[model samples]
Target: MPRFAGKTHTAGHIFFYEEMVVIGAIFGTIFSVFYPFFQFYKWIGNSPVWETVYIILGQLFLCLYGFFAGIFVGCLALAIAEMLNSIPIFARRTKFRHGIGVVILFMALGKSVGSFIYFLKQLFVCGGM
Candidate 1:
């Protein structure tokens, strides 16, 4: 028997890819973006000695120049995840869609640089670094 369901506007197949993209984003955001911060908070909430460690890490890891650095990372994570979600749809349409990924990568790079600069400023001013 021939494979009846492949492409050409099949609702179920399209939905599957869309769902795949969304799920990938959710997983990526949770694992890459939030896990470290959550672990830090849990650490701080539990121990006294670790509180010092937490603050130091917060200064070094979570802040830049002197401001909260987590926001930039989180935003970049979200942007990358969304771009990944777009991949499934774009891949099916045109070879040029590959270029979309490059664009997304540049966006992510921009986010990273901006976040790093912002945090570096915080590190200097707030003594977080």
Candidate 2:
């Protein structure tokens, strides 16, 4: 089956539709696995059995939060990128439409950079690293 639905009339009109959300969530979970901070490790350390369960649940909850946050930030960045692409200079460029793959590349790159900055800022602010 086709991944994208609906019609397209202009550049920046293409979207992942609802697919990006699901994809983002999957990526977020994958991201969580690689995330460096072990925020719950101390809390879970040599704990009572019940506390271990609670800590595990808490970690799961944080992972879920990260997942949703990733989707939210990605969608926001995409919307911002689309707005930039709508500017007359960009909109009028033939390559802008012809190279839709480039648009996706830039959008993903933008999102990655923005997320990294956010992660670093959070780490600094939380004094955890």
Q: Estimate every model's Cα lDDT from 0 to 1.
A: 0.66, 0.67
Off by over 4 Å in 1: 1-83, 87-95, 123-129
For residues 1-129, could you state the per-residue lDDT of candidate 1 as single tens digits? Answer: 011224244656766756765997798689765667666566547676778777797778544633534644665676667768887677667666446768777877998998898786876565455
Cα misplacement distance, residue 103 of candidate 2 (Å): 18
Among all windows of 10 consecutive residues in model 2, the one with the lowest summed lDDT is 1-10
Candidate 1, residue 26: how far the Cα is off, in Å:
25
The deviation in Å at residue 9 for candidate 2 is 18
TM-score of 1: 0.28
**CA error at residue 126 for candidate 2, angstroms:** 7.7
TM-scores, one per candidate: 0.28, 0.33
Which one is best on lDDT? Answer: 2
